[model samples]
Target: MAVLALDPHIAPPAIVLQVADRERPAAGGGRLLPSGFLSTSGSQIVDAGGRSVRIASIGWNGTDSPPGAVLAGLWQVSYRTVLDAIVAGGFNTVRIPWTDAGLDVPLNGYNDRLGWIHTSLNWDLVADPAPDANGRYRYVTTLQLFEKVVSYAGQIGLKVIFDHHTNEGTEQKNGLWFDLGPGSAGRDGGVKGRVTAETFKQNWVRIARTFAGNPTVIGFDLHNEPNGEKGLITWGGGGPTDIKAMCETVGAAIQSVNRDALIICPGPFFYAPPPAASGMDPGFATPSGNLTAAGTNPVKLPIANKLVYTVHEYPDEVSDIARFDLAQSGAAYVDRMNRGWGYLVRDNIAPVWIGEMGSSLRTQADRDWAATLIGYMSGDYGNQGGPTFGPGQQPISGSWWLIGPSNDPPYGIQTEWGIGNFRSEQRDITDRMLMR
Candidate 1:
């Protein structure tokens, strides 16, 4: 593994060092230190004044309709509508979920999918086999759209985190090469497995090569939710070798090409703690629970010395049936936090950003659960050093980007399902998270 040197032109702002002293009363008598920047064993980010504000980012998944529709007149709103909402809602950053398919796929030509209209088209295709009536090559459309999205966000004062959501299929479901399953060209545990190391390197190389020198882009997430496969085997470490290699390969790729952005690697299954090496049986654990077992690779692999470990937390997953069953009341919900998220944080060997977490108002119970979870995120749960890793602090940065148009239906589904037509609320989440 190789470490990257910071470009002299883009040297990070000088970091302020806050020393830990046991004698100072202002330090909360060694309980909690003041709200000043402190040095850690990793990279540093500072403001213009050389102060590190606890990065309180607001993020959301940014994919839905095609870039053409977004730039064109889909729902009669520009991509800026979402960014504008973010600024209005007090946010400063955005995580734009982009797929490589738009670039990699061979397009035949540039024909408007919708009725003939003249407007801005955000997506571009690579023109592999030459453009046909359908449109340009997938890769070309992707690149054009990415540039536009990043440029637009930068113009509006929002930092952009380019997330490569899918490598093979669309960004909606089990499309990554790894999730292809049995008899597929890119099945799990195979050389082309979705989370395998080789695929990680290849995809990232293409991505890093493309985005080199772009300043607005913040970081790269190696893989998302790298678990939940039956009869699947990991690399030499018995954990997700592909996912870990992704951190190294993608980190190195970005560093080799563009060395300014941070590198983020997520834990398995929405950041759930992996099970023991023996693996968690189906009857013993839920679909979202860790399968790698308790003593497996806790931190997968570090991102070549400069990066942040991202973890996702949700009430639906992580917690066992006993805890969730009792979550009817606020007290039980807090208990679930301790047993679920708390354990993972303590045991996991990385500082984390709760990458994705949100709930909807489908039912009164659901709303109550969501609200309670939000309160915990806002710092209400007392520190409980129980179970595996012991007490730990909640992620200081994350996304509350999901907002539903109706109480029953979740909004921002576009980011997950829609290939090009991303919803405004989804983009709004990105704007908020990228806030400085």
Candidate 2:
């Protein structure tokens, strides 16, 4: 069921980290991502030397959950071991989804937050060597743990993207980025305080400044699946529920601090606009993949080529009459790609990251859907069209939905007793999905 990458006891081989700075020379250890900072060239994400880079990322969820949190498996295994396993498993990048409430957990409070990590396996997390006067300093803040996660990932050659999964450990069902309002259901129902648009942007700015020169910290995924429907989360209208406007606003704010930071924007659930004529059919789009609105009113940021669009494609294996195509491949999903946001790749609009996607390898429908979707992004169109993996037209790249320590039926990347482990089958699909 679950496959262990290495012994959970031993740490990965210790290697000296040569930080990316003028003070030190560029380090090399066969890093998967390019050495320099990343920028965009039309549709391609290019390194400083202008070589194209494909973002093969895996979304690591759970810290975005309610109450205080830590990166999932740290309680069962060492953070070092789990992170090393990510690289060993053949992934180049990792996306850490976090909530504001989790970020506010203080150092001393982490004693309770880290759960079982208080054991000797991850001593550094609970208490680090400290100044003699203070006996021992406890580096126990969730924020500190988050920074350590970023630092070690970079040291070991994996780039990171921190996603604002939710504001206060509560899902944004209301579709408003600013205030979920009173009786918002979770995170103590604004007992800590409500999340205003300005405060949200400022929170991101603080995170950006925290990792200012860290090359390993690549980008900020502004929001996770602003999956609100038409009446709720519209794009570009500049209304209260305008996610497009919010992305640009928050993105530009983060850039004011970390200018080189890549601003990733995810739109609302589906773009079903009112019929141009009285009786026309409503349009459909993947979750957070509302590029129909973006096509006409593209997100304009302060910096050039710094904007990237992200979408989640949690497609059902079988077609639903409710949503057309659904990556079922019968109607030439590539044709849909050409007509939809996926067209951004062929047209070289901006880089599109499939931010989240996955399925159980059990059923044939699931298998076919996974293959077709990954193939589409990798430029294979599954006999629908020719592959377009080249400079300027680099195939679309993205993070798989998640990796968890559970069987999770249709979507888990890990199998039974999955801590310090992963599913070999999922790993195989991930290998194929990664951009070469």
Candidate 3:
């Protein structure tokens, strides 16, 4: 791979938000009553007057690694280029994915005096206890890079959501998530492994505590995409992993440390399935007899008010949108979401956000599907009473397109798979909808 530029640019001015205790207007009510700064064992958010901000955001894993690409140095000059483009395109938030282990080198772009930078540079070359020894456990680079990114986004009015793509390893299948334990079940299972479950709660605590006071951090995603047989069931138990239960556990961990930050938890199948056990994977449900062990226990945590259910709608197999040529009409697009997209977000009461969407799909059919899906979720989801935690309760709070070097020309600048085409095109579409 070619080495891109890696020179630290001077940091921009930071936003100085007033911290106070005041009641902000709710979506549609008298208002959420006044309260003090949101506090937790790990950290605190909210101003002295009690106004909390939600992260209406986007996801970009650049400045890090792609499935088949080499690791880019954190200070790579393109990091700034990509970030500048994203901000210029009008996105005010970014979900940064980093390996759980840590980074081995120092990012050299900003003035070395940034607080997050100085505090995060420990020079520890270990991926122990959690990520093992492979390059996966490294959070050193993630810590430095994300802090800078988050700080920068704050300067530009964007929020930040930190996500852990995997623990550590050389290769991954289809760019999935980290499982809890060992073997195929844990590695490529996409949060199906025990290692994930084992370490997740603690991870939340650490992360929540780190950004406790910064409202610019929208929240933390416990895990990316929960999948596989051993993965989370809707409940908690030995039967399999229970995403609902995982939410409770991880949510509590975050709440324990910083009660004010929001918690965004993706549904099973990465938002690919509905509540019905039929469309869902057998493993995601508890074992036939372990009903009690399933994660059915009610979640009674304080952060429940701030909980947001996350799911994705990519156009791979199973998406009804892909079955027909959707590039044709508005009605077809609406129909696809009503059938497939609607099913995913309608069941939950908490706000629903399309955490990940956009495909490297290659066809007019695919592109049409993308346009419709993006339109439906960002526009229609709000029209329909999907789920929302904040005042408006809009079902589709946010959406982002996946990007990589794979997105080269021709289709360039218009689609995620074709590079240049997607950035400009997605930005145009997104800007029209979001107005950021």
Candidate 4:
């Protein structure tokens, strides 16, 4: 293991420095941290050995869907095949998004909601279980299936980031973290039911205990994009409804079960109008919040060296893409990021991971935007034809929005399965991803 040089001006916070000195024991009389576990040091994510590692990852979505299933079933490929494809695609991590209800219920119970869309289980690829009292075969539970997925991913040398994709058992469209309602409808106007914050925390506690010692399961993304009614999107203010408070509450719970677990908190989602006559669109929105102000303070956890701030970015979500041209320059784009979540890295407060970002690259403008964003992540300021970060400012890490078999416009990274060919739209994006 080798140690990378950190920005001298941007020292890690006191809590992180203390953890590195105490928890990260020098191995073989060398500065190497350890292997297996991962923790944050300032704007960098280091392995147990303390070597800097970037999370060039892709989201393996589907856990939020009925039955906690992954896209592997839709692709008719084994979960191993999907994991292999992720590694072969030059990614080091996989973000697995799952729902609380899906994990608590039995596979069959949740699958019933899949109706006609559910794929036949590839039993050989998954877990094997004993028959029930009636001598009938019983499929593995969703929790068991996820454990299998994590185990296989580790076998293939891929890091797993468990994401709480939703509180409901069905599709995730509601922006709230734990929707406790009398009759709340989903984004599709269907009632998916509700869950209390207490129930949400309990499920996470159970999840943390389940994979407490698993090194492959490095990070626990507390919630997917936390946005909804006014109270739900609370940043640092808004009392108990504040997302920062929720993160601290849930993060502490996870750490109690697994101290080494990295707690990732996604920023709030809101629209920010672009500069007047700046050629950018007005309806531009991102799952990032400006935490540079006095009221919007940075998230501080009781535990050390484990908190990671995250945000989601998308092109279509922006108000106007035509005006926000990336071909000419990336100044506007970089500024938008700064106002969103870049401040964390810029100020050296904590490691900021762009948890989700994707584009179809359907048009030249889309392709340019992708290139600019990728260049920024890679620390290639010149590639975007824009101003670069200052001496102490470090490049940030990010993961693509999704990788699935379905060709759902720009979000899908692959059209088919089995690690063959990715969609045409992914050609440019894949090239920019860091292998290690």
CA displacement after TM-score superposition, residue 122 of candidate 3 (Å): 18
Question: For each candidate, what is the lDDT?
Answer: 0.42, 0.64, 0.44, 0.61
Q: Residue 96 deviation, candidate 2, in Å?
A: 0.3
**What tens-digit string does per-residue lDDT give for candidate 3 at 57-117?**
4466533342222122222323443444444444545677655443333332233221111
Decide which is better by lDDT, 2 or 4. 2
Instruction: Report the poorest 10 consecutive residues by lDDT, candidate 3.
Output: 14-23
RMSD of 2: 6.6
Residue 92 lDDT, candidate 4, scale 0-100: 68
Ranking by lDDT: 2, 4, 3, 1
Best model number under lDDT: 2
Q: Candidate 2's error at 381, in angstroms?
A: 2.2
Q: What is the lDDT of residue 3 in candidate 3?
A: 21
Estimated TM-score for each candidate: 0.61, 0.81, 0.61, 0.77
Global Cα lDDT for candidate 4 = 0.61
Clashes of each: 47, 1, 60, 6
Ten residues in sequence with the least summed lDDT for candidate 2: 21-30
Tell me which of candidates 2 and 3 scores higher on lDDT: 2
- Higher lDDT: candidate 1 or 3? 3
